[model samples]
Target: MPTPIPPGSANETALLDLLRRHPRVLLTGPPGSGKTTLVHRVATRLADQGQACHCLAADPGLPGFGPPGAICLGRWDPRLDEGGGWRLETIEALATLDSARFRLPLVEAVRRLAARTEAGPLLIDAPGVERGIGGAELLAALVNASHAGAVVRLAPENAPDPYAQERVALGLEVLKLPAAPEARHPGHQLRTQRRTEAWDTYLTEAVEQSLDLVDLAIVGTPPPHDVTAAWHRRQAGLLDATGRTLAMGEVLALEGGRLKLLAPPLGDTPRTLVIRDAMRHSEGHLGTARPYRAPYPATPDEPSLRLPLQEAVDGPRPTLRLDGVRATLVNGVFGDPLLHLRLRHRKRSLLFDLGDPGRLPARLAHQVSDVFISHAHFDHIGGFLWLLRSRIGDYTPCRVYGPPGLAGHLDGLMRGILWDRVEEKAPRFEVFELHDERLAHYRLVAGQPMKALSPREVDDGVLHVEPGFRVRAVTLDHGTPVLAFAFEPDVEVKVRKERLDAHGWAPGPWLGELKQHVHAGVDETVIELPDGSQRTVAELAQHLLLSQPGKRLVYATDFGDTPDNRERLLRLARGAEVLFCEASFREDQAEQARRTGHLTARGCGEIAAAAAVGQLVPFHFSRRHVDDVGELYEEIRRHFPRLAATPGSDPYSEVD
Candidate 1:
């Protein structure tokens, strides 16, 4: 482990220097590591230099800018206080916090904060759980979403570094500093006392208010369903539409279709009431309340119905999950043709086409590791700049595969942008263009010209291959050569926990060996166990393994309804679990579809039926059908009975 810098005023100068290079910094350490003290010192120094600093208090357990059970955002400006002392004024609670269930929401809140155009540096005070797997995962999620370029770690004397592995994994600049001399671990009693004092201070001007339940939405946890039980108190936060906490209170009563809360006076009616952990106030002191254990009844499933095309296009978006991938249409059917596919358990994603990605969230855009371009139309590639902007600080290179001339198009697009201040940390792109059984490669990075690499020959139309899946591409004429892609996964072998438990065997690394043997068809091979024992691979496979076939998804769009195009599409899409095909015109307007190099509703349905696909999802509809798009769905339903009613609906479940 590297030795940390000694504690002194020089450390403050080093931190300020780091802040100059990286505007956003995350301060993380274990309990009693003086992370909060360091945050104060940094804020004071910045304020002394006439710079404002934004601070995010993320540890719900420890009271900082906000009370316990809440994540707060606050700022320290030099002009706010006349004395020029360090003070975090204008604090707002961003979200009601829970350790296990609210991690993702917290990360999202951080992302939104980082995207804002604030005038000062942002310092995040992370929780003190830097030693376990859960802590590591939480830290990683926060760092990724916070857009933080550096992390400052504070450790006690002679303590092992808890963030060493994660620093290297995330490629973040880290500065290690020693803990403060006065830092000491607080006991359980002291922690509870501090929480009580915080609550008292926060609720000094308390008042009672009765609110109608019908006008407010309940977030976080819902009240118990049984109305007859004795009314119990639960800590709650009132928030507006923007997620700013209006007030914190305790639910005193829930009856007569109304809620009574004891809290500070509210300026206006809150939009939401976020119920947190059970708590109560007794004789001016806060304490834990009894837990509610009665299970709420399950919500009944809604019946599926075929909605009109206009309603479907304007309705809420849906996410469909196949065996190993989750798919979403970027802009529904009426806008552009972009399909987002995220591999389950892979922490990575692929974009079927580079259509306008402005609707995609920042986190999702950052996860895109590869992109497949059907053609380089303006609508198909207009949002490439947005994608690039979202991944400015990410180190992973995004690989793009497309038809011929794609490298040249990307080179021209990249050359238009000025990279004068772009650093080496900017995102990179690896472009692969397929032309006549050969794949040409081009590398793109900010502040550098595109570099061409040697071309590689590909057979069987396999353009890209990974360990668990492969992507195959084929060209179809759509006025221009357009690419269609098929994503096929290898066979899956899963462990049967019931069988292993029945044999009184514990799961370990041997399961991976068993899977490898089964996947490689080496069932007769012997497997070694961790306990210095040996077992036959065949016996383990018979007792504990279940083999299943993998699913395939196909994406074909923007191709005319010609015989040649139909044949190529069917050859690539046959037996696919889900086929996302284009239906840009009505059945009677086949001539218009052909003229525009698109497919009609009837043509899409016929192709899906002929290819024997399990489900057909028709998208990229013409705007003219906004009023009477039902006819298009009816036409497709006449030919393909397994057509999805709406893009939001799950097409895979219909086949099952």
Candidate 2:
């Protein structure tokens, strides 16, 4: 550990002088380096000199001046100092431990605070993320967003500086200081203990209050808007319209459109309740609560078929599978149309549409790497902003594929936002626009306008190809041109476990290499065994490998029921394991479906049957038929007997 900078010493004086010269400063270091303590001392010294100083606690995990899972802004008043500190004046619970959820909002908050002319220097206490690629990107975004003139780093001697590249790139002044002598690293248990203490202190003057849920807008992790049921107790932060935290409370009960919460007495009515992690009070300590699981109810009209994708109301769940890939709907069948496919053995996921991405949890939303847009309707592309928000600080680029003019539409959306504070580390979007015979490419980055790249000629309507699968697209008419997509995987090659065991061979990277060679049609390569024996690829493949066709999934939506569209859809969806087609209206409302450039339930079924698909999963129903969606299902079953139930629509009574 490094020696402490003694109080009233020349080093301390120089640090104070450096802080005074910068209007905004970031106090950053690894955990246990005493960055929080240094912030307090600097604020106190500035206050002692009659200078008004503001402190922004930006670390949600171990906030020094606010409740846990929130960013706090407060002022230091020397007159009220009696060894105890002043409470946080304003709090914003943007997210818990995930910085991606709150990155953009946090930057806006800092810019607003720094713009205030009446306030003195702003001292920002940044989170302790001084290592790894994620940490470096996070810190760079913060430095750029806050527009901090200087960064005061506190670490032990001989510690490598993580922000050396950023400091030079941004032209920022660096101040190195020694860690506090009393600094001690906090474990997870200790961190939780401290957070509970902060919560307890925040509710010292709290009381129980009941308010009408209809009168207040719910933010963050809100319950289903249409469902009416008792939810498990959860922690929440009350805020007024101006984004100021009114009180921190626990949701005691929710019934009859009324919400009961225990929090400090409010002088004004709160307009919004920002839900935090599920929590409950045990004895006197705040602890984690079991997750809330809703009961599944069968549709009143049909006993065997469950509701239309009830799981979408709660969150995404794997309702169906195409081989090893799990599929989910971002919103229910009656809601927006968005299909999420969790790829097999991959950390990343794919999106068929961008509808209501807020329906996904923060963790899963960040895993989205590829987006396929059928059309540019608000219901299809409106969630692009939320997707961008969840991926702002991540290093992976999000690739988007859509119909013609998609690049222009997405570029217009990106240009609408003010990106002055965004840095080079922010999220990047690669948009691919599918034309008649070629795909146009465009690149978009925060703080810069979209740039067009050279177009690539489409080969057999194939849009994207990877190691195991390829994505192909075809244009359909939906008043406007809409692109229907097919996800086709290459032939699967599985090793025969019995043969491997008989040969005394164990699974290893060699098997993967063998599979790859087989996939590439290589037959002459030699394969070495663990026993120092070698065999030709042809001989080894014949003895060990079994080849089978990979499962295929097709996504078609928002297209008119016409001969041209039907032919195109059939060609793309033929022999697919599952076809997610849109049945927007029932047969009784065929005129309405035709006018809206959508397919009736009967038309959707005919197409599925013509394509000879294994299963037909219908979605994107017209809201006008929400009350009688069972009829639509029956209509589809009439033409295609292999209709499948919606995801999470199994007859199970309770959620696991």
Candidate 3:
């Protein structure tokens, strides 16, 4: 049963009908227009009818609207209790909002509620009076929710409510839905001036005086007209140039190269149109329109290259994998202080580092996803300038990650170099400055810096838990704080291949799936063998069959041998078939290594021996020891005895 619809005014019933049809609703009006009270009444009605309805207030400081059928969730209670019930909350807890700074958290909350409800209805009450903050935010919230599988609803009455007609119009525009001719505002009236001739003369003089470039600089330029056509022409010219060098689906410089486009929507072709820059750029004009078009490139190639998103609204987080090799090698040295990891799984092999990449080693230039940097050290990041300007990789966005300085660093880099290139080459670099405490589970998307990831933080950790494995990071002694990571698969193998085959079970990809299903506690997992045989997981277990522990890999570098550091390394590297350590120095250069607080080949070997690791492979060698790399390897082997002597190859080579 559902609670009766809240009725007092005719508009209330109409709005309730809209809410019934559309689960996601953004109700906006002037202060005291009853947006909050209306939302609460509707929620109460839904609850009375046995439906799961939650009305979350956009403000944290606001008092609770009532009790248990609806619980108030604030910073104090972020997680919705594991029960079929409604929970009220501030927008921050419900979403990833930074109200004071005007950052909205709609996507994160929408994703969580979507997962919990199986497409149940959710109503968000936005702060209606803070128009500057609330107007754009409410608009964005509606847009994002619609994109994420929620049906959106709105009230467009204009007599008693404010901005209602405009809000409805904007929603239709954003959703690309057909617009309904709205009723006119009942009491709206135009102000008339008594001295019309005098006003006309004053306006004529103002228009004439504002046309000069110098005056425009001092007083700011006017909106779209014959005078601003030149600016549009120049912009179109640059976008044409950009299309020549870059491909479709790639990011580009826009708004004087300060913004990064994630991926252009389908069917739009590249052509420039002069228009007002969004919030990031200064307002171009008030009460005026400007020419705008989808200047972004839209080619057939773009659609084929776009990464497939998972069905779940919370986009898939794909880690770098080598495809054939369990480990992908990080290479390259010319760029900034960033290390490079070349992924071997996809058509494009990506380079992860920050540095000047001049004519990307032929192998990397044609690849689709390249240049994801780790941090912002100039030595690591300087090469990005050349890469961005070169128009290589079809101008595909090169994603970057680092601490707080990333966004500013990228902005400065672009502004210092080629800001106007936005019209020519779409800005291809996207930066994210990680702030963990402020946004527990929100990671700014590659292109959409404004939206944060929806995953909730389970612990004080950056890596989220996956279905089969967990990723963990530890601080390394890099003089500067740096982290090393490891991935541990949770599945354990209990039966040997020979034993399974002896029991007439055939081996195939499906067998692996069957094992996973069984390990996940699926009781009736039936495996079909290669010879058309079938068997239950219970039967296999009855025969003492099970899974073995999965593989373990650890990466550690830029650390010295402090007792705790050594112990951490030992535990992480213990039994690892392959261990990669920083061999910045040789045994003879131990003094230099100690002074620099980096590991020598001998020191790495010592640590490997102490940890009882199976193999020690040293890297991060100093340029001074380039010629003596072999000798250094031999010296390290003398101490560890298990150092593998396999000749290392340039992992970034495309030929392999």
Who is ahead in lDDT, 2 or 3?
2
Clashing pairs in 2: 206-264
Which tens-of-lDDT digit does each residue in 361-390 have in candidate 2?
A: 655666778899999999999988888777
Kindly list the per-residue Cα lDDT of model 1 for residues 61-172, writing each as its tens digit.
5646656666667777555446433343423342233443457666665666556537568888887766446677878888987788898887776878756888779898
Q: For model 1, state the Cα shift of residue 597 in Å.
A: 1.0
**Which window of 10 residues has the lowest lDDT sum in candidate 2?**
647-656
Which candidate has the highest TM-score of all? 1
TM-score of each: 0.57, 0.53, 0.37
Local accuracy by lDDT, each model: 0.72, 0.74, 0.42
Question: What is candidate 3's lDDT per residue for 1-656, written digit by digit as tens?
Answer: 97664343344555557666676555544333455555555655565566666554443112133111111222212223442233423212211112322233333434343334334555555443333445556555644653322222333333333344555655442111111222111110010111122222212322110012221111112132332321321111002222220111111233331223322232323333212211111122111112232122223432321222111111111122321122433332111233333322223443444444542453354453434344565655687665555442235555444444555656666556534424534545554434443322222222223333353332443342444445444545546544454545565544566876676543434444555565567758786555556768776555645555655555666666566677767766778656666677777777877787778787888888877776665666677753345566666777887644332222332122
Global Cα lDDT for candidate 3: 0.42
TM-score for predicted model 1 compared with the true structure: 0.57
